[model samples]
Target chain A: MKLINKRNFISIVCIFFTLITCGKLLYERALNFTDRYYTDNIFTILGFSVLITLILSLHFYLQKFPFWLVIIAQYALTVGIVFLAIFIHGRFSTNAPTAYWDMFVSITIPFLIGALVYYICFFVQIKRANKVLEKLNSEE
Target chain B: MKLIKTREENLEENYLELHYDKIDEETNAVLDRLRDTLRYIEGTYEDKKVTIALTDIFYIETVDRKTFAYTKDMSVEIKEALKDILEEYSKIGFVRISKSVIVNIFKIKKLQGDINMRVIIFLKNDEKLIMNRSYKNDFYKRLNDLKGRSAK
Candidate 1:
């Protein structure tokens, strides 16, 4: 199947980037960090989000490819990008390698949860579609 | 053209026979329509050739230059090329939903909108196929025509 058009993809990426940046701002504010580089954090978040979006969109072109291959490639890229971003952020902030590991764990745990939620939702959609198919076939 | 009706008491099955002096566009159209009326297509199941009824197919898909017709419980390899099969069966209900797939519209129970302008067609067999953007217009037009005809 064809992918989302370029225009729509761009719009969606921009909207999500904005939301993520806002979320980051709120998270840091709630933690009450004494020293905050708002502009630098926004830029880092922007770069990370854009990279993740690009990685995820690669699946659109790989529609004919094996599903497992696509999912594995995307998941690998996402994890790698998240780890690299956190590592770099930690290096610039505190120069502590241990902090980077902690940050990575914090980020990846939520990402894994999100992936699990996605699979659950996908399963539900298929189940509902099957039910509708049965109903329609019965009517026929 | 003249129409003729013949009654034969010993005939086993009804058949249409055409006698023409020359083949033209109109004659080709009639022949095409007649071909589409055929009920079965040749397929290979377990290395043995079989005739699969058109109504039994959920969808036909081309993969790596080979074509397969999927039914509720089995998938049979069709010898005919995807385009040729579609050409012969499109008049009945076969519609190209993507570059490599032709779905029997009658087997589609419902269509759901998918992200990225694609459509998910749920079939009677609890299978789903994606209708690509490039073929969306033609597929929808054919569906509308089918609906119109059935309403009459």
Candidate 2:
């Protein structure tokens, strides 16, 4: 599997951008922040998106292993990258330990949502393929 | 194109012929399927030559430069290259799913999606084949085309 191809890169960016935007909206609504706000660190978000894309592309390389193992590895890599990014941006030094926990929760929520969406799409595609297969088999 | 048929008493064999001004993609597909309909290859099993019908083959795989055709009950070593077989039978539902494996779409009982965009093919004979990620798109497209053809 070739990683970081144009098609996959575009897909990753789209999914990541949508997930981030929705997450931001949910966060603002929960906090009662009425004003439309965006993150100031555009580079951070872009860099994080690229890194996440690379990490997710690892799934193709590790396909020979069990599905559960691949999921666990991807999730762990995602969490690690998120925390590493936070640390590098100097947020770790200024925030309390509880703030780190909040960050972890934030990371986990979006990751879980992305995973769920992926699985749903994958299963739906498989179901359609199976239906076609059944029809073909019966025809024979 | 014109349709013509004739019934003859005590005919020894049946024959079909086509006369066309030019061959297009659709015409080529029809010709290939016509060729595939009566296709058979000589294979070796237990040091004996066996005539294997193309329709009875579930899949073909090449291992260490030796190509083998697998049927529901037996495997036979064939002299034909995988590439030639696919070129001849692709219009009849044979598709390459990996570097070394060509599977008969009609022989596939079902398909399951594996992690990382790979596909697991379940054959009617209770065997499994993993479709490579690179070939997944072509496989799906071919399968969809076959489905449309069947619907028609």
The local lDDT score (0 to 100) that residue B75 gets in candidate 1 is 93
Worst 10 residues of 2 chain B by lDDT: B110-119
**Model 1, range B64-124, lDDT digits (tens) per residue?**
9999999888799988888898777787878998889999887988777643334688787
Worst 10 residues of 1 chain A by lDDT: A127-136
Question: Which residue pairs collide, candidate 1?
Answer: none
Q: Which run of 10 residues does model 1 chain B get worst, by summed lDDT? A: B110-119
Candidate 2 residue B150 Cα shift, in angstroms, is: 2.6
Q: Please give, for every candidate in the order listed, the TM-score of chain B alone compared with the true chain B.
A: 0.74, 0.76
Tens digit per residue, CA lDDT, model 1, A72-95: 677777777767766676667664
User: Against the hidden true structure, what lDDT does model 2 obtain?
Assistant: 0.78
Alpha-carbon shift of residue A75 in model 2 (angstroms): 1.8
For all the models shown, what interface RMSD does each have?
7.6, 3.4
Please, what are the lDDT tens digits per residue for candidate 2 over residues B35-140? 7766888999889999988888999999999999999988999999999998878878899998899999989988888655567899989999998766766787
Candidate 1 scores an fnat of 0.09
